[model samples]
Target: MGMTEKQLKSSNKPDKEMPLVQYENVTKKFGDVEVLKGLDLEIKQGEKVALIGPSGSGKTTIIRMLMTLEKPSGGVISLNGEPLWHKKIGDKLVPADEKHLRKLRSDIGMVFQHFNLFPHMTILRNVTEAPIHVLGLSKEEANERAVDMLNKVGLGDKLDAYPEQLSGGQKQRVAIARAVVMHPKVMLFDEVTSALDPELVGEVLQVIRDLAKETDMAMILVTHEMDFARDIADRVVFLHNGQIEEEGHPEDIFETPESERLQGFLSRFLNT
Candidate 1:
């Protein structure tokens, strides 16, 4: 069966009318260069959003902030309407401490461009470890969940293989399964296919597309693949110079971009 036929099921149904993620005037800077400038974006529960732009456009930084891998220099980010980087201290909001951050981070999962798996662990172990330790699942429970996820990613037969043994696409699918098995409220994909070979990229993308279809978790993908963006996203955001340049339904953003900058940006991908 194809990757699309592999089912990654979720029990939580999303409340689409409510916002799941909010970036309120968020900003990020690395010394002299500001990577994000007063960025404001919201993602509703169960929505799939794609961020597309050139390098250094801050697309990755946005999701990195959401993943808590990078902290913003200004403004607030909220998960489920609660401040992500801040904690409620009596009547005032204070920068979140480790306790504050950890609680919220549990609700988020991120898959990076590189497959950051445990090289020595088998594929099943890599996928099961997090849920077992973090979520406090029994070894038996974690194994069952891991097996189901591995099957869903077309890696069931490769469960005993180590990361070094699997191909790039298969490793990425394992990474995806690892994240999804956590049952996070939000899933972030940061250029997941960028490190894959051209021939292998399709398999990883197909796994992601399958998960996107099955999960109720809000998904934010920072990618350069135009057709993948068109295929998997409900909304496409075009970023330029650390800000959202244009965003709308994929049809509008891909087929009828109003901004010259976006048109030029898409042309490079669409033309060749």
Candidate 2:
């Protein structure tokens, strides 16, 4: 989607009254282990927020629920002000069926810690597969979209390369290109750099930064890159024990954390 002047301007100042994504008192559990506890968060169109904390802090769970990869044990998740996991029938909100879930999942894109590419497919085919099958785009249209996105992510030269032939960073960039080609309204990054070598992280992050600037896509990153988070996120949230310990503007959260939990987390996370 080519951005007109108005669309570009909208990314800079997203409206707040109607949130594009909302999680109200959300909870999740595996057996008796609770992963998310009464979580509440709101994200607006074109906004970028980073979630940071120690291992098992519920950051990934939040996005997984939104992506419809995992259902919440309780509470409601809404996308564009409509219930995500349930549908309204008359006056009651009922559990959503497969059709509802599949349609909602199409509106969001997610990149996991691993590249998750198909070893059997070429780079260009990898990027084009979802659009052709899921979105029902014509083969020519999907190929056109894939080629343009591959060029943007600096993988145009490697179109015929297989996943096993590419470096880790290149694979992740392909993953980004694949997700972005679909024009998702929301993008989820779950520790995208965690599986990469130190030297490879910057290139992937740079691609994300460019996307953040170019599109009005709302982004939520579960990341450990303190500097990257500071530079990219409009807001930073610190989570602990499945709850938000504290949250604020990146500067406030990083520079002068008011809560002991966040302060300790930063000190330990950054120094390690």
Candidate 3:
């Protein structure tokens, strides 16, 4: 599929001096278990970073924290250089109010491992609902934007179809369309292709690759697909024990990992 006019016009140009997302001394704990331990990370505008790790290595937790599904036990997350979990109250930082958090979170969008679609709504309606309500666009405007987004994901003909009518791959594409309709500055993809069959994973990954090429959104993906990560991500981060064990360009990380933990993790897939 050819890039849409909107995609053609989209630029990946980003401000080099400022990071689009920052995790500063971020920590998360549940009871006595620390899921994330004083981790720091940064994603520049238009950068694609993939988080890869063994199970329980805290890859998914990082994405969840960015989406505000979970709160940090310590430290701060910043979006566009402003605090995401806290609000400035006359030079003092305080936990953000609900209103403030919602406003700040509007710039982010997430896609989950499971396709979270409204079963009762048509594909088009599923995509349009958020823009109409959260973005306050008129119904007509939302519909137009939704249609364009669906087409971008190669689902223009499925607009009238319900969730059950689509295959697993198609449903995931619809989910991607729904998220893209909001035009989020940063997109969080948490094991997006993990739930699909082997044959179905390619189509969803293709959509993501196109998004990376066509738009400038900063994308953070937690994925097990090593080849896909190498192909799409500018940087690959291997997380272990709630921290970044090693990070570098895809070629460097995949070819010559310095950490024994990362080498062991990669060998499971690479040697196979």
User: lDDT (0-100) at residue 209 of candidate 1?
Assistant: 94
lDDT of 1 by residue, 1-272 (tens): 11111011111344355579888788999999999988878788888999999999999999999888999999989999899999888978899998889999999999989989899899999989989999999999999999999999999999899999889999999999999999999999999999999999999999999999988888999998889999999888899999878888888888889889999998998789
TM-score of 3: 0.93
CA lDDT scores, all candidates in order = 0.89, 0.90, 0.89
lDDT of 3 by residue, 174-253 (tens): 99999888999999999999999999999999999999999999999999999999999998889998987888788888
TM-score against truth, every candidate: 0.93, 0.93, 0.93
Please report the TM-score between candidate 2 and the true structure: 0.93
lDDT of 2 by residue, 159-202 (tens): 99999999999999999998998889999999999999999999
Candidate 2 colliding pairs:
none
Q: Candidate 1 — which residues are off by over 4 angstroms?
A: 1-16
